[model samples]
Target: MMASNIELEQFYSREVEFPSPLLASHIKTAEREVHTLLAGMRSILRKNIDPSIEELIVQTGSSYEGLKVKGKMELDFMIVLFHPKFIFIPVTSDYSGYCKIKFQQEQLQSEMQSSKKWTSSSPPHSFQYDFTSDGYLIPSEIYKWFQSLADKAVNQNKSKFVRKFVGNLPARTLILNISPGVDICVDLVPAICIDRDLYVVAKPLKTSPDPHLWRLSLSVFEKKILSQHQSSCHLKALKILKYLREHDTRLEETSQFASGICSYHLKTASLHQLAQRPDTPEGLLEHLHQLMDFLIECMQRRELNHFFIGNPSSLAEKAKVPSNITHGERCLNLFDDKFVKESTLNQARERLVKIKGSLPAIIQQHSGPVAYSCNIY
Candidate 1:
């Protein structure tokens, strides 16, 4: 008979809580097996140093790195120490994709930092939500785009997508993965307390080697970090850029009635022909431009109506717009050397235009359709 998954999960949980001497022996055995797989790579870990921080350290096994290596090497290992107060939030899961979860998390963290009672006393909390969130579905159309790029990978480009993201410690960082097995559960997860301090608990889970993990990691980290700093603007631009790159001028019609073919003559074409053609690059660009324009205009108008004075730089410098913009006030720029400049506004405008130009010929080939797509974004 085989042990059920639930039974195995329960068994693992008990090893944390009860830790019988017999179970301890089993843990050692598991650690030995894991170490064998590592082949004596120097282990890096974080240890609790204060209420809010875990210190980082690296340790080598009973061996040196420079010697001529031949056979595989193995050494003992241990799970990183964990504090118990924080909830263990898994940032990746087996069932759904990771792109949305990572985006949501970055958005949530940004919001938290902007709140009135922000503090550095607690460990940061992270989580991976189920796939039903609105953010998750927005990017599904791009999955096909990623797949095409993956197929193009050659020996010269294998490491192009991999990068080290953490500032203080060297560790692999990526935001997307398909596997449920990788230990994405944060080590020492943090929880907030009444005194505004934080508590951390549980180490991250270890994962088996899987190509999906690598792919997902690249997608999530890159997407999330870019979205965070660029304030959703860059992501919108990038999406349009990537779309044009993938589809080119080929019309492969999907099964939606609201859709129609790109760059084909309408009067003499059959409904099937119209539906089967690729969507227009011009239409896509127009859609995206409208969105970016709207956002920029709102921000600009808010600034102008508030003070009705100064330049763009001053408005950008303010922590918050004055009561006039929100309360009652042509938008005006309160100028400052650091904040307002003609170049900045031009850059924003140019970004919109540049994204519009980069689409496939099916879009750019026509004027009206390109306008539609740019506006949609």
Candidate 2:
């Protein structure tokens, strides 16, 4: 039998909003397991390639980000290496930094085919690579080094959590099979820590994309923002947004990846809506409505501006802008460059265009109205 609106609302609260304590404990345990393996891996990297890559940043997971379902969690952890050798003193120019990055590009060729998505076509024309001391590496170098470590770990059974090879690309991947049946997989991504204090992040754009450079990934900052959000409504709204997205298949066949729309896009929309509306119980229903409405507008416009991140070059401000030709002519809009690539976005347009019209009925049916208070308050 189908659950009524009240039951559905209760289910969301009991399931997503307040996930079981046992499930929460499991997430924490899984994270601890992932961290233990990464610690060993980091030790290996330090002993082999460079001694400075000491820590891996837990980029996203239920334990930290509050963006996880009860049973499932996606661990997007990143290995950050500090520039091999460096000491910095304040400089008179726009910034202060020391150490030049000498990139190792030889090994990247092997996995270039696998990493074609992140691999860039052309190199950034000009920019001072002085922050090598700040965890940064040539895409290929990071991939090759980590690949060796992961392979060795698996072959030697170095870590108890060692999983078989899930992907060939070394940087953006390396899923660990901590358990059987792939019940728990941790994604180890190699990222250049552009600015740790700011949580400014960039990924290796190897080839098959625009250029070989550091693409912005401000998800950490977004996670931080959501952490400090005034209400848990934002999280609730995000959960529902994801549920609706997965359940609604208006354009199922058009997804570039698993689902046409992604969690990042959904989270981005939810955050934006929360900024305007309060993230309270009374505000959640309207929040979902506004969130979907915003997504529809973005699809109709054929552009979805990244709320937290922007072009990496002009990252001095609160939001970055596209660099001028002098700085590599990076894409000003992150949506255009990263999140939903042109091809994927184009494929999703048909589905997106129809979403607003279909969302109301879907919400009315799936998301019960019992929890919402429509009054202006």
Candidate 3:
């Protein structure tokens, strides 16, 4: 049976939502400290380490997007780089939502000639050693170089934070111990700014034979689209869905499928729903139902189109990719066969069916008589 609007509202407020006053206060304090650390690191990188390349640190991910749920306080930052001597060529691949990073022939020839015996540990003569003989920028090598520089910067600074490297090799994770039992995890990702709107990150496939591929990042556009929406309920609905996805035990049993379902997928589904129904819903319950239904439909079909790919009229305009970038007009399916297996999709569909069937009971169980809350740290 369907849950009543009142029940859904109570469930969302008591269980899914965090107290904004507390969340905001905690986030603000954390952001201040994080900014200080980043500023110190940026200064060192520019003046002492590498003056040839310019770096801009951009805050991204759900924490900054105001969609973060409880028990997750990690922050994401993109170290957007612009080198006067380097030119990146974004090559579209057969894999949807993924591209390869290549260098222009002239730039490669010049760098190769100048630095014949360049080493990673040596002073920054040029970035020639980070690329392959064929002019392709190796993702792992570049990541390592950036990591080394970040390590040096952290060491030079006399801050009270202890840094560590975690997660995938593409990014560096810094764990800042602010106080007793309060540690903030910051992920610093290195990216090449192709244009004002377009960025190619050094993210590579976990198991792919080729490690030179760079993933396209639409984080800037996503923030713009999400912020432009007038309805607060839309954002609330997305948060509730993310909380459910993170906490659900049925989905957890299918580990592969659950891992495959990223927060971006939920956000994309919500954006599509928002586009379909432009008018703001009357309440949070209505919006949450609409978003869940849309997500289930996407899972059942085993297809979710990337929000920004091939839609030049609407999302593409929002993306603002330069005409010279040359991303093809074909729709890029988020659930490409190369990335997600057929069996995993079948398992995901079945699990979602069961989850939707008992959603009300799940909500009731989670929503206690008193509202649930957590400490920020």
Number of the top TM-score candidate: 3
User: Any residue pairs clashing in model 3, and if so which?
Assistant: none
- The residue-by-residue lDDT of candidate 3 on 7-103, one tens digit each, is 8667667776656785666566656655665566566654322423343567788776777766445677887765554555555546545676665
TM-score: the better of candidates 1 and 3: 3
List model 2 lDDT by residue over 1-377, tens digit each: 33244544565665455345844554565567656656656555543235355555646644457766543344567666565342222111211111123443333334444444433674321111212322333445446666667666456445565444564443434344434444444566655554553322234433234223344445566666667663466676677667655545434444442365677777766656655554355555655556766776676565665554322322223333223211433223435533456666655655654554565554545443222111110
- State each candidate's clash count: 51, 8, 0
Q: All candidates: CA RMSD in angstroms?
A: 25.1, 11.0, 4.4
Q: Per-model C-alpha lDDT, please? A: 0.25, 0.49, 0.66
TM-score of each: 0.21, 0.65, 0.81
The segments of candidate 1 whose C-alpha lies over 4 angstroms from its true place after superposition are: 1-48, 52-238, 241-286, 295-342, 354-377
lDDT of 1 by residue, 163-256 (tens): 2111111121121111232111101111112111111111111232221111111111112222333322222232332333223223332311
Q: Which 10 consecutive positions of candidate 3 have the poorest summed lDDT?
A: 368-377
Top-lDDT candidate index: 3
Q: Report the Cα lDDT for candidate 1.
A: 0.25
Ranking by lDDT: 3, 2, 1
